[model samples]
Target chain A: MTAHASPIGPGPTGPGPTAPPPAPPAVSPLRLVATLGISGALAGLLLVSVHRVTEPVIAAHKQRVLEDAVLEVLAGPTSYRTLYLVDGAFTPDLPAGADPRTLDTVYAGLGDDGARLDGFAIPASKPGFQDKVSLLFGWEPKDGTVRAIRVLESRETPGLGDRIEKDPAFAAGFVGRTTPLVGVKAGRGTGAPSEVDMITGATISSRTVIDAIDTTLARLRPALDAYAAEAAR
Target chain B: MKETTAREDLLRGIWRENPVLVQMLGLCPTLAVTNSVANSLAMGIATAFVLLGSSVLVASVKRLVPGEVRISAYVLIIATFVTVADMALEALAPGIHKALGAFIALIVVNCIILGRQEAFASKRPVGRAALDALGTGAGFVIALVLMGSVREVLGSGSFLGHPLFGAHYEPWVVMILPPGGFLTLGSILIALSWLRRRRAAAAGEARS
Candidate 1:
């Protein structure tokens, strides 16, 4: 087979063909298999080596990011522990044979005394304008209000819908807001305990954030209340 | 096979045949990540690394592969390099990696890297292939940065992350959005063609 010419290049400039090129020799199947096998093996070896080297680093980076987000939402908790919900109850330890990734989990933060419960940083995600928007918010059971919020992941439209994450004003509006939060027009928030001003051009995305929190709280509030009561006891 | 000088191979992709601006290859990543200068630079460097590494490997192993499996072999090599780039970026520069997101993995399918392996690297010596890859990589970087600068300044009223026009400047929000990418790229293409035509006209006038 003739070599495929690239249109990106200045077309073939080989020495002026004095005559037509000679017919190419046929290739054997054995050589083709050998070539592919060798290539695959080499590729595998390179990937394995790189993966081994970077796996720990990538894991550490992810761990740090999660910890930082949790701490930020929880307002500098002295310590935090992962709690998994299984069979209608929250457990501090992972259940046998259950992947931590697939289970509902929250990070419970402790105050400076290391024994007093500060609050919980709960992560939730829901469909937004472009893709799923994932976020973490601190829920204070004492006051039954959202303490702080941070957007962990989002693919919203930049400079518009993305303001749900990038705009501090929008994020601040969620702080100290009660459940069943109401989204009002921008600059029209009545300063009520549960009122949040939606971003001007990102009403849907803004609402998605509120809805995700509300849905998550509705599903997990009973379990959280039980956990809080047990801790109080 | 054509005999390309080292200089020609090194310089061709930069201006005469830029991968993004001139040839329009890899436009997906070009448009997706060029909203900010930092993201654009990270993407450019990552793509350049993959292209250069794959070109060298393909050139070194050109003789061993039969024509029937050349494409597969090249893809395997390119994918390996892309994976390595992805891992390294995630570990070393997590922020940039997060900003780039799926575009880094999408580099595996970029036509520019595979196109070079098929056309230039497979047919040329190792040195020539390396030079060509560097040239193409540089061209890609320049085009991305150019688009990024225009979009960031107009879209956010900032260059990089620093505000350029103070607080009063009202950013043309459309410049940084999806439409901004296309608008900036189209404007650049128009400007490039206009420049080329002007140069051609000048040359014609001199000749006449």
Candidate 2:
């Protein structure tokens, strides 16, 4: 009968060896450990490489957003010329044609001459009721004005204090206002033609915007003057 | 492990061998990136890429790894793939990358990667391990996208950048906050459980 069963496990009648004997329950501990360690090292290297590659693209995107804001604030047929830090030694590197007027706060995109493009304004941040509030303002040296204002960052309450951001009439009030903007009540005539209307419930936020402008001008005026003087020469 | 039947291997991640909703693994990335659709999608892609890459490499070298120090070995392999995803994000789309912040780096701790290595990849053939990783990763991506869409729509009135609702929507701003993240997840889990129970009852009726 050709034995009818293979011999290897528990002999012919007990259990068939042809069944593969459960493959001896191979544990293979050494193989598992080594594979894991080597695989981990490779993955680490891959993560580092990808992070390095994406950093610049992200920065430029923010710059683009800022540039869009700057255009709303600057005046005349002007274009962004260049920036020079009053304190930084790199001021010497200011481009030859750069008007050197703007570039107080950053995130503004640079124009052809390496100056901040005319359309974008400086982005500034300051402490507000709960957290930091950031704003963008157009710095138009032509009339020595801050053309417009927009809130870029805030963490105030949504319906209450956040009304500062919620109310467009409040933001629209700041447009075309000259430097050193004075803020006041919205109705009954208190502002210069360029004066901004205050947010009814969020006086603190309104004040923060006014102060950021004050602070920006405190530092930005000198830089603007230098550029204006050069433009005249 | 014995070479799994094709159907069984594919079904593992759904329930009996789930990496997240069932096993409660990978909670850190799960919570941190579920705030918005963009964030969740980015995280899901990075993880899937890492899982796929590492699983294949581990399975290919299964015979070479020593048994004594496998855990350390597995971590090193996973970290390498994560680095690749990070650099790509940093270089190509830095805004999204910056928005995601440290959570991308934290993908290294995600239990999904290590679990696959220990439970399936180490024992399986290279091809099987890679496919298994892909399936599990796709499942994870689906979960993240679902979670992020709910949060973004409820939290911001925006779904993948479109105004899904009109201006009157209140946008439950809390949906974007940390507490909202926890609350949304709890509700999602409850909904998932109700679905499972209904499905089970239907199946039992059919059997009877």
Question: What TM-score, over all chains together, does every model reach?
Answer: 0.89, 0.70
Per-residue lDDT tens digits for candidate 1, residues B1-208, read 5566789888988878887777777888889999899899999999999999999988898887777677888888888999999999999999999889999999988888887887778777899889999999999999899999999999888888999999999888888778999999999988988998999999999999
Docking outcome class, model 1: acceptable
* TM-score of candidate 1 relative to the true fold: 0.89
lDDT of 1 by residue, A137-179 (tens): 9999877799899998897987789988899888998999998
lDDT of 2 by residue, A1-233 (tens): 01222232122221112231122245576655545544555554554555455556656776676555665555332345334564632243565665555534333334456553343366667888878888877666667676667787687766556666677777677777776877776674554665667777777888888888888777767665665555446
iRMS of every model, one decimal?
A: 6.2, 16.6
User: What value does the lDDT take at residue B4 in candidate 2?
Assistant: 67
Best by DockQ: 1
**Which CAPRI quality tier does the interface of model 2 achieve?**
acceptable
Error of 1 at B2 (Å): 2.9
Give the residue spans of candidate 1 off by over 4 A: A1-28, A113-116, A157-160, A186-192
User: What's the distance in Å from true for residue B9, model 1?
Assistant: 0.7
Instruction: Return the top candidate by TM-score.
Output: 1
For residue B70, give model 2's deviation from the true position in Å: 4.4
